[model samples]
Target chain A: MKEAAGRRRQSAAASPCAACKLLRRRCVQGCVFAPHFPAEEPRKFACVHKVFGASNVSKLLQEMAEQHRGDAVRSLVFEADARVRDPVYGCVALISSLHRQIQSLQAQLALSQAHILHLRMRRTAAAHLASGDHITSASASSLSLEVDQTARFY
Target chain B: MKEAAGRRRQSAAASPCAACKLLRRRCVQGCVFAPHFPAEEPRKFACVHKVFGASNVSKLLQEMAEQHRGDAVRSLVFEADARVRDPVYGCVALISSLHRQIQSLQAQLALSQAHILHLRMRRTAAAHLASGDHITSASASSLSLEVDQTARFY
Candidate 1:
């Protein structure tokens, strides 16, 4: 046990994972976060620690699948960075601003669609008027025939 | 001048407008906020004044048209209330949360639309197959007539 503790101390001094380093804990072999969060980028874990705290992060990582851990860590880091920068709203502010943009876009889209529908209706009405004028101009002898044709067309 | 001063003193003593009272200023006859922000509802102006400051609110009301002032004041009061509750995020947090809801709703709407389109396409395909079976069962003697009818229908 003493030899194992000495070896762990040597390993911890050499290269502790960011999470362990930030929390000032000894990083054991096959640590859960070691693969995803390396010892090189200390700031990543710092941000996450500040926002979510180390214990909650540990529980979260433990609950998640191994394959999904990397993505989860990435999301946490991003959210933490946002939280550090904007303590009040964090990522929520960005989402809100984006939502406002989408609303304005939707309104514009509705207006444009209405305008297109109006134009199509006007075009159809004009075409009908023009066809009616042609029928009116036709000989009186063919008036009944023209009317039947117009009725069929409609 | 003395008479005018006495009259002003009498009016000021009667009941100062909320904005002037909160800001510790004399409410003159032509005070801009007097008509909208009465002394009775001092809390409304208090919240607005705390969040936006009396000077900024005054400037904003002065710049806007009379028709828009009511809406501006309402918005200010609401924002101020939110700010008092959450000094960090304030109104921005509400905006951000609302934005998230909008995004989720939009995603749901898009998914529903896509599902509808998929269902419509499947129904159309099924209808086409059913019509094809009918065409195949029709008598061979009426094949040309059927073809002509189908062409016209198309």
Candidate 2:
């Protein structure tokens, strides 16, 4: 255990994390920023650091439970990257965009429902006509949209 | 403008913004935290500061244009509040929920689409029968689901 700790300390000192590299500081052992902000992805730490300073990020990580720190860091990094790309809207913009997509999909569902109803009505009229019932074109077009719910689903 | 600034300074000193009040510091003239983190809503700034220190929040707001600062502040406040409530997922949870809703909506749309196609095929079979094509019940009931896409739409 002591040997492993010693090696980690030495490695941490030699290869600082992205946060420490950006701030020009040595990454000490058990750094709150080290695990989340790896040295390979320097831009991740840069954006997070620019949005939320290292001191504050450090404090936040220290405050949260170890299990949740990864999720928290991911959320922070995503928000930070969004903030940099869009200074005004950020993550909220994506939320609204998703909302718009949902709205459009709902509209499509409604249209499909109406089309289905019309087709069902036409099929009913065709069945009646084929069964020797005298049905005019005008009457067929005026067939009701409402039908037996059980049969409509099939 | 100078008179207005002076009045703001006096009011700020007396009322001190939420950020300053929480930190037990004076709300100085042109404090970035004043406008968005009003004194009436101290919890807003409290959460934001706890997650991403007041200094970092202030810096983030200052870096953005004055016109966009309000929106940026709103986003920060929402993210901070969500973070406090959900230490792990935060706003990402809401994003995932929206995605789930979209998925369900898509499923509904697909079902409706299939229903429409089935209805169209039944109507085509009924039309052939009504025209005295001598189609039996089994033949009519086993109508092909595939039909002209343009005709299926209606």
Q: What is the interface RMSD of each candidate, in Å?
A: 12.2, 1.7
Task: Please provide, for model 2 over A119-153, each residue's C-alpha lDDT reduced to its tens digit, 9 standing for 90 to 100.
Answer: 76766665675578887777644553255432454
Quick one: best TM-score, which candidate?
A: 2
Per-prediction DockQ comes to 0.03, 0.53
Q: What is the interface RMSD of candidate 1, in Å?
A: 12.2
Off by over 4 Å in 2: A1-13, A132-154, B1-13, B132-154
True contacts kept of 1: 0.02
Q: Which 10 consecutive residues of model 1 chain A have the lowest summed lDDT?
A: A113-122
Q: Among all windows of ten consecutive residues in candidate 2 chain A, which has the lowest summed lDDT?
A: A144-153
Report per-candidate TM-score of chain A alone: 0.74, 0.76
- The sequence of per-residue lDDT tens digits that candidate 2 reaches over residues B54-116 is 777777788878888988888878877887898777777888899999999998897788777
lDDT of 2 at A59: 76
Chain B TM-score list for all models: 0.69, 0.78
TM-score, cand. 2 vs. native = 0.75
